[model samples]
Target chain A: MIFPALRVLVPVALVIALVAIGLRIGDALGIGPDPAFTLLAGALFGVLLQRSRFCFYCILRELFEDRDSRASYGLLVALAVGSLGYVAMFGSWVADPGAGRLPPDAHIGPVSWVLVVAGLAFGIGMTLSGSCISAHLYRLGEGSVLSPFALVGALAGFVLGFASWDHLYVETISRAPTEWLPARFGYGGAVLLQLAVLGALALLLMRRLPARPARDAAAWRLRAVLDAVFVRRWPAWVGGAGVGMLGFIAYFRTSPLGVTAELGSRARTLAERLDLIPGRLAGLDGFSGCATVVIDALMTENGVFILALVAGSLAAAIGAGAFRPRRQPLHRYPLALLGGVLMGWGAMVALGCTVGVLLSGISAFALSGWVFGAAVVAGVWVSLAVRNRVRMRLSARHPAG
Target chain B: MSTLSKSLRRTAALLLALPLLAAGQAVADGPVVSTSWLAERLGDERIRVVEVSVEPGRFERGHIPGAVNFRWHTDLVDPVRRDIASPEAFSKLVSEAGIDADTTVVLYGDHNNWFAAWGAWIFDLYGHDNVVLLDGGRDKWQRENREMSRRPARHAATDYQLDVAKPELRARLADVLEVVEGEHRAALLDIRSPAEFEGRIFAPPGIQELAIRAGHIPGAKNVPWDRVVRDDGTFRDTEELRRLYADIGIDGSDPVIVYCRIGERSAHSWFVLSRILGYEARQYDGSWTEWGNAVGVPIDNPAGTVWGGT
Candidate 1:
């Protein structure tokens, strides 16, 4: 009885304390109400994310590993919806598309072979770590032991990325052209091209929908709504819409929706404070990435959003009675750490993760997004093949076990 | 389970309170400003916004309402020599743009603001009073849904008096050679790509910016010029910038000389180091073109065993 009560009390206390702290910091910084609003918005996003399990890792895992693509449609819907939002915001600029003047700060990077390497590494990392950066944040709320390690590894990866960026940027990234679809095809053409591709994929996935249980003839449909909203799984379409709308709202209200930048920022700040990193990293401040430095390190818009995201997930998990901790083998911890390293490095080099690069980038009509997405899929396929081989080998060695 | 639950609740409460304990104002008022900052001060009388781009008509298409166009290649660069324009020519360019000595020129453009930084470096070279790079360049402004106009700006040309061109602001081939010979203890910053540092490929695959031989200056560290900025083309905060260079042993105390293929990319670094971080830094405009081609000068080729042939 006490444990159950503690769950409710703890999250409530956390929300109140966090809000108070956020407000205090905002006041101190003279940023007014921006931090508080972002905090609350982040919480909402977290709740939606937790309730729907809107994770890139899980979606891709199900698609490739389980031979199920139902959840994958959520991502497609997100892109489709997000692309429309971007079009609405960027329609005027797209009216005149020139090679020299592509839409700026849209997460579109130079299309290069490095993208394939980054994607492959990210896929391997996701498989090993069991979650993407965004997924890990929500999972941390539900008390996943592996998330913290993965995040730490991601931080380390960012540092490593900085170390190696000189070679990558000068050699590979500079060699390739930044391919923005709108620059070549114009805004309408690019949006239509993207929609057609996404729509076709969505239609194909719809045909492969999992069989649903027959409804009781006398039971009301509203009865199922509660289960969908609270206890049971949400339909792919609902999750898709929810995630899509959230992405749109995030971009509309603040900057692009990204989780890794904040992670990188905290890591860089901590490392700098500890004197672990260089006093001046050569040319690191200028290039565009999700991990741009913030004025208020502790109470940045992204930081608040990330915190609320975890809190929101915790709330949802407790409410749904799904906050139970899972038992795992000791070996999984080390493996997860290794996975985290790969994820951090991959995301750092790729300039964003699945959410930042694949979703947000494509939505902005950046060809780098398409390149990353394709590479990630290929990586996932390769990793699945390797996993299957390993599993088969293990079974062959110990048939009884 | 009860003990675990109790501890979890305590941890949650503590985590929530962490923000209140946080302190320090990480931002500093300096050369870089956000689109919002510039937007608020858009029509200020003392500020002059200059749109620098390689592409023609980019400013004509849409720009910050009052910004004048500065064609970096045609206007800033000397049409004759592979060098920045003469002081007299630069004076004419800025004076025509309605900028005087005290005018705070905010430079912004596309192409990762490379040309803008180049413009900023040129202004600093001639000792312009206040020159700044618009953080994230025009992209951030556009992304934020800020106001833009197609009307070409016209201003009363002022006789902007330029101070004597500071030769110390620039690193000549002789200075680079001194570092190469180990006579001077300075950080040689090669802002070129790694492949260029190594003798793998000459210029970027497409562009004509190339050297006769590949590789970096001896003792020069390869810190690609793009590393100093975020993906949106904004300079990183001071702390981040400090650690980035410190990590590479560029603590800003030692005199640093930055260079690239033809000095365009390195100019961006020079701006960041000298203007943003206040480092004792200089840009070697001759860069690889001079270093890579000059006879009898030592070159460090990482890709192959060969030194300098051509």
Candidate 2:
């Protein structure tokens, strides 16, 4: 038992120590403390995501298929918490909430039909791939064989997005409205309204939640504590609250909590280098989501954050004994790739993935966020229904098998 | 001393002083300085370093030691109008930035000194006599691992007065229109990317300020601003620059009017033409934004691209 426990504890401890030392060295090198802080934030986020199993697609699917509203509640709680934190930050940053000027570097993207289309595609991609982009990152730590193919597919999708960007920009995105909730209602008003909406949704979801088993009271013991920490999956609300707090802290310290900026930037840089895309992608830079740029430096803030996120998730997964690598069937590879491509293109067009546009956007109280979230939900629902119908028909035809 | 001997002696003295005078003038009036030159004179009281990067908060992150930051949007332009800063505002800005009449202002910035050249143009407009661009600007300095400081430099403020505004240095919309209509003899130089010049795109991706229409002024020669700079962001030698322009019949004999999407990029080209290669040039500060958006301006768009159309 001691040897087995050491196998989990030693690696996790080494990871934490290495992170601490890396932060110190990074600060000493004159890159400033922002990168170090971002690394820490990403690590914390990874641990929370992995331990809580806070996957957007998984939660939504569970709600639709199994009528499990528990994980969905966690997501709502995260949004609510994030929204409250954002309002507080916004209040301090811009005293007059009605001011037309947006808080700098917030994920307030333009609202348009393109965003809806992107969100739908992303949702469908999530369904097909079995994870959202953020989920793929965490699950990569969990040794998901398909995550690599999906990520590669996403890179290709970004290239495709660059190809299609100019026409779309001219048609719709150029004229799209960037709606900030605080601009319409005051900070207090905006938070309250968002909370009310979230509350209503939460109540609606609660009706579908299955009854929980009563907890058996036990005396406090070291073994029990270790089991709870390392063996048991965290409650949905705990993960939701952790995620929300992290999002707030991330925005306050660094930029917004985004995972795809680095990925998109890499794709953009590569595409530009290969001359695969046009020299100019019109209106791509003006609007803020996860704005992609041609690579100038080896390490960007987002790049470092993502690297640390993976590392942190790996540590958590190891400790939880959840880093189980399983061989997937051959056919699932193609689906993962296709799904990744869809998600990549969607994220590129929309300027962010689930974590970037939906989570961060909604927290910042941008109307685009809510629109994206609704569209994503509708997409997931529709795709799941269609898939279920297809499966049923196939099974009906092959009853003996 | 006889009269003949006195005149000969005087001539000899004047001839001896010619090279010395020329060298002194070069030191004082040259429009661009290399990094080593500026680095050697880091703490010289007569020199002031100014950063005018397009990206916000870059100055705060790190800049050349003792350099002051000037935000392009608010500091360089009129807050209320779509124009350069008013005379009074410009005076106040210079005064607050510790610039004086005798100060040799060394300007540098990010994006290969795109906005820094704009600053130089503005300085020229206001007739600052001793201003020079730091050759290669901030990019080269940073790439070479020069020292940078986050601490804001504190310098004693001086009452920096604006000299007579140089009107010939700037070209207005009417001036560009006259050139387009064949009334002016000046050569029209569009310094935007080929895509922008050919009307395939309205503006560079991610740039907010855009024209309603896409294309260049009719008969304008396309030479992207970046053609003047090397990979390291330093300006190419005089001979190369001259050859580049001479290919399009701009051999410095003809007055050149340079323009880009906005005036900033054109200012870079204007710096190259007027300062580096000694050409008679005026920056059409209005540029494509003014030309393309004007109600009935004649434009030569090869791609035939239209706004809101495929």
Candidate 3:
């Protein structure tokens, strides 16, 4: 009954409450707060994401494993639009200004070996966990009892991550530097290089041959075209571009692109405030806090956009009647849990996840993106190898999971 | 809508050739429900009340009628796996709590419903679609002058099914390690305090002899958990939640991992960001204890950082 008035009213009301609380807490903590507008946008995004399912894990799985690369369309659209917007605003934010490389926060870090390694771990983990970090949250909204374990596991990985810092800094990423940006290629060259790559990849991935191969595609389905107009549908090339653009726009708005940092950083502050976690870890006490340091963190326009994607998804899923709360398999939870652990550990090691390092990095022309992307593929393959070996061992004669 | 408004809408649709999509308010199953709605529902037999709480003994003191106790940690997970309970175990456990496949579990708890929503998260993880977290949880329930039962109720157990088709939803230890190593797909998030993050002096309650060097992972940022929730236990406004994350450098787009010491405190945050807020996020199960205890992994102490040798 109240849905009509609630949309605008709720957001406004929520905004008021948010500002009041933010100011109150900022004063007590003695930390200067960022402008409320950005914060409000972020909150709306949170609400949107919870409602939608704009998650990289969901989209990626749908693309590669399921051959249903529709969800990623929204991300691509976001990237395309955001990219143009970012390019328009890049000068004020960059050191060289002319380099198409707007900055680190716009897209992914760039191509790198470790990035691929970490991506593989995260990808496999999502397979096992049944929900990526973001999806895991929405699942919570719908009432899931198992997400907490992933949380516990992630924390453990972070703590354990301390044990691996030296290797991470030295062996894993001693040379993982930004790549592909205008800084390296110069403005025109960088733009041309990116366009060339995206165009080629899109062409190959989206090739269409005999319609008989895919029944869905065989039929002259108006739904596909309609979906393009209304919702995300087939041939996610355009969507991928959008996502890339969104990554571009994110940093142009004056902050880096990311998701885990805001939540993770907040978790740290909460633990400190409550005395649950020790006041120090990794030597940079105040360096990583949301109160004092915003640069190193990943929260910003992209955070809010994340929510918008979710909301957009929610709108689509609900509209399509495909929104059903599901029950995950019991036997597979061990794998899911372990996968989650790996994702946490890998995210810890890599300093970002697929969305941060791969998607954001790639869009930003950072070398880390390629590295993580490739690493993730390799990691998944390694998992396949392990699975193969495990099957061999478990069933010398008769095999199974 | 009025005739003029409807006419304008029609005109815009015909002229623009764009879908006139409308998204209603994102309604919770129950958002800030009144005390009366809750009271009436309490007597309904179809509503199975479950007290999913943090800490021990609280359920015994007083609880909603017919509610069973489910600890946020010990009762739901295999102490070692970094994800949700095994479906086999979850089915058995939830059933033991008297939850049937269709049972609508109305969960509540002590502080701002962290454990309660967490309980809800568990149900979702197990494929239960009918679970609900009581707004205000026990605190608001009590403040609203609702009744409480001091005696523990004798309840029956029911079955639950956690489908395995969605196994790709979680993050694993390797995933966390990858982030630490700066692999880059998804990053490990340390939602510990600044001190804990820096390895200055965090030994979660009983985690003595953390002989491992003290510090957070090199790239992990420290955002406390409660920033996601409010002081009164209700969730902060959506915008507040957004800013909280942004300030901490967390954008909703990237793959994110949230963690705390035992994951209980951090569970609150996981609930807020991933659950309530809907970011593609997961929680670290083992937390610091498991992380710091191992050798040759990774560690970042506070600025005065130190690492325990392998």
Candidate 4:
């Protein structure tokens, strides 16, 4: 009883303490109240994420590895809800696309062949690292040993991405189009198009989702809120809806929901300050991609947001008695690190991670989102095949096991 | 309840309640006005709204009820030289637009207010006393679901007199060269993409490369023009803008000359520095087109080689 209570208490106390400390630091640095807002938003994101397990990698792995598409349906639900919210907020632009105006600050980036390559690398990285960037944050909160190594690797990958950005950008990205659907199709047409596509995908995935057992009276009652919050994994649809709502709220209140901006900027700033990278990072500030620049202060809105995400996830995990920290084999650390580097590089090149590029990007009616999403799935397919082949060979070599 | 569980409950409540407790408004009065502010003052005889979007149809389709169209290319530029309209021509345009010396001219547009800022810069150059930009521009108004009208509101022509043009507020190629060579006491800021600044890529695809070579002015610090604004196209608070420029060693100690490919993007930065941050800043309208092509002038092409011939 004491252990269970302590587990819950410790995470909550730590999160509050961290947030308070962050606010104080932000105050000293003169960033104002944005840090507090970001941290709270992050914590909320973490709680929702921990309870739902709404990770891109996990969802994809379930679909491919277990032939279960429930999580895939969850992703579709999220897209559908997010698109509706975007439409409501951005209705004016949607109503009049002839204005030739696109929504400012949306996750839309330039569509190029470089994006496809980046998505593929991101997929491979996600597989090797065992989680996407957001997932890694939440999972790290739950004491996942592999996350630290993956994060470090991602930092290294950002440096690599920064270094190679000039060459790739000059050749491929410079030629690509940054198309918004509402610009080509009217706002109504774009919304209808997204809804139809998402609806069809949901139907397709629904057929593959396994049936569930009947729930008891207590499970259906008001007590279910508590049960769902602290004792059970939320249904995929609920998780998806929650995430979409959060994304909508975050966009309206602050910036669009993104996890990589802080990481990318930090890495870029650190590298440039250390003289490891050049002062001018080409095309980074001009166009909409995972853009990073050095700011005067150490703590940014994104940094606070991400930190709070981890805290929220920790609280949720501990409350639900799911804060399991498992040790990994020493050899796996290297692979995790490599995976992180690839993810970092891909995310930077692509301008966002899975959620940032695919989810938020799509919701904003950008075609780049679809392109990145398709490329990532394709990359995952190829990596899975290669991994399976390697595993088979290794098994054959050690038949005694 | 157990001690741990009780404490956890209190912590959760405190975390949720913190936002409410941290209450203070940062009333930043930049050279900007909200949609509501404009709405309340709309149709007032003294307030004139000028829409300066790149797309021509936007003004035709609908706009902030009574905004006059100020096409950056056709209306704002001089036909003979690749420069802003002559003071006489600008005076006529402003007069035609019914913007007198005392009139409160509010400018707005799309593409993150790129052209709007350009219009504001030209107005400032001509020394307009009361000029302001709509924060977040036309997008913000539309997003707010405010009233829009297709019926153009024409204003009677007024004699818009200019005593003198503020040439000091507008940096020429020569002024930029001085700042670049460190001969002048000013901050030379290149507000272009990193690739463009580093000479990795010339112009973005589709646009003709203005400069014979891809690069930036020497000793000019690169600060991507978009840093001063939020995702919603609205400029950040004054405190944030102050810190961003300060971090890059850009204080109000010396004047700042901002430039981009054609001076449009840099004008946005100029608005931020001069209007928002209240700094002594100017836009180099000649920008890369003049800098990159000029003979005997210095060009810092780090990645690509500069062309030898004209």
- Write down the lDDT that model 3 would get: 0.56
Candidate ranking (DockQ, best to worst): 2, 4, 1, 3
Q: List candidate 4 segments past 4 Å from native.
A: A14-33, A93-95, A220-224, A273-275, B1-82, B85-103, B106-121, B124-310
Tens digit of per-residue lDDT, candidate 3, span B8-51: 99998777653222221122264234345557666454567777
Superposed model 1: Cα runs more than 4 Å off? A1-33, A93-95, A216-226, A269-283, A292-296, B1-310
Model 4 residue A287 CA deviation (Å) reads 1.7
The deviation in Å at residue A13 for candidate 4 is 2.8
lDDT of each: 0.77, 0.85, 0.56, 0.82
Judging by lDDT against the true structure, name the best candidate.
Answer: 2
- By the TM-score metric, which is better: model 1 or model 3? 1
Instruction: Give the runs in model 2 whose Cα sits over 4 Å from its true position.
Output: A1-6, A13-17, A24-33, B1-54, B57-71, B74-82, B86-310
The 10-residue segment with the lowest total lDDT in model 2 chain A: A25-34
Residue-level error in angstroms, candidate 1, position A240: 2.6
**Model 3: CA > 4 A from native:** A1-36, A43-53, A69-82, A95-113, A138-148, A170-176, A208-249, A266-324, A378-401, B1-310
**TM-score per candidate, in order?**
0.58, 0.65, 0.43, 0.67
Cα lDDT of model 4 by residue, A1-401, tens digit:
32977776887797778777766664343332245566677888898888889898999888888889988877888888988887776764334665666664678888998899999999999888888888999998787999999998998899899999888888888888888898888778999999999988877787677888777667667778778767688888888998888887666555678888888888888888888887776677776545676755767778878888898888888888888888888878998999999999999999998888898899888899999999888887788788889989999999875
**TM-score of model 1 (CA atoms):** 0.58
Q: On a 0 to 100 scale, what is the lDDT of residue A173 in model 4? A: 83
Strongest candidate by TM-score: 4
The global Cα lDDT (0 to 1) of model 2 is: 0.85
